[model samples]
Target: MQFQKKEQYRRQEIWELVKGKEEKISRNFQQSGYERIDDNLFAFVNIGYQGHAGQAFPNQYDTDTERLLWYGKKETHSKQPLMKRLIDGAITFYCFARWNDDPNFTFLGTGKLVNYRDNFTEVFNKDGTQTFCLELEFDLGDNSIHPAWINNFDASFEAEPPDTKEGKEKYVRHKTRERDPAVVKAKKDEFQKEHGRVFCEACGFDFKKTYGARGDAFIECHHNVPLHSILGETQTKTSDLTLLCSNCHRMVHRKKDWLTLPQLKSLMERN
Candidate 1:
């Protein structure tokens, strides 16, 4: 069950998708914040909200969407069966975030674990109970997360448009302008006008040279501006794209911070 980015979902809707009218599972439907439907996790998160144990978990996502901190639920411990699912094998972590008191949650996409601190969080409850929770840092994947997270973080829905800041800054991600065919053609047109054909900007790998005329005008477009560096405020332009061969594009996104074009070239120089 995959949740699309920026799409708002209700508790019942999620229950329907994960378990189809299964009574026992639906009974515990809204009970667990971290629910496991098979190997993957669905995090129903409310930042700065108090759990039933009166212990409010300090779930936070920085403006850059760099360090996504998820607090374990009440009585959750390190090395537990469920907790192990986070870093165990190749599992996807999905997040649904909402404004305070909002009915629906917007999907934040799959996350990649960067760091985990077992029992590093302390929460004081209103009932005089102290809970030591675990904190896990899972930076959401750029492609699936940037759009949804950009719309809701720090947003207040009571008396506003829910975009937080009342400015004219527009970002394309959900509909994903970068992947649009028109955008790709525009970039190719501009690049061919200047450089004659598409090639890797970082390593200068010409696909056509490597594979005859069959690879003509063939190159991948790396979004170039790292999502973490975007801070959810800048508009991506055609110039923001950098044409690259497949290998160089993957290398650029190998790390969380994402390597710049110059940094990739420096590595090539060393090699």
Candidate 2:
């Protein structure tokens, strides 16, 4: 499946993104199964209709770490079971999160089922009948989308190789900002309006142009002004935000002395 626009997925629209054209079966998290345990980590449960009313016991799901164990739905009597689709290698899953009521679901990127097991667990039905149902375990695949908002996820501004003096100074100079989603959208929209498309301001790399549908309108937001340089509590203007491709963003922070936008442009020209 091609990557859908992240902005297009907002509020209740997530259901459409997850189910696609498929009819809505159940509204229960286990049925429409998605767990937003943290900002970076998400799990999709493929449990079928069985044990729908039972307690969801998430084994090995420790919030402090990146590891997650999703319990698959109990096997159903259907011809092609949902749990069966997970076993097949062709099916791909993407995780999403709407952290702290941010309005937009942060696309946590694609994941693959790492491991599975057959287990019998106690499940209590609505009528109070207790039954042990068969369940499968699913582990998240890729670690590409590690956002700082996640509880234990590494922050981008953290000190690099803290043993050296330069590393310690870089850490002290690093600062983080509380950016507003609305402002970030406005900045992207405003740039797209004038330039006809959003691209890396430094390298002119466009995600949509390169990856087609999957990468449409996807660009990392960078705070232009150094966070540590701000004197007091100040509002961030849209002009203060710059758009960059992931590669350029990493290059900007490649060294202890962060590269300014102009400096990056200069290096690009020299090359």
lDDT of 2 by residue, 50-164 (tens): 3344443444433334334544334421113333333332234455433233345555345444434444445555787654443432333344333321111123223232222
By TM-score, who's the top model here? Answer: 1
TM-scores for all candidates: the values are 0.48, 0.38
Q: lDDT per residue, candidate 1, 1-271, as tens digits? A: 7668779998788877777766445544575676767545788877776656554558887646645678877667546755653543223578887646577987876776655665654766567767677777776766433222221111211223232222223342211111233444566679989987778888889989989888877777665654333333444466877787778866765443468888999999999
Q: What's the lDDT of the predicted structure labeled candidate 2?
A: 0.48
Candidate of highest lDDT? 1
| Span of 10 residues, lowest total lDDT, candidate 1 | 148-157
Cα RMSD for candidate 1? 13.2
lDDT of each: 0.62, 0.48
Error of 1 at 31 (Å): 2.8
Report model 1's TM-score to 2 decimal places: 0.48
Question: lDDT of candidate 1?
Answer: 0.62
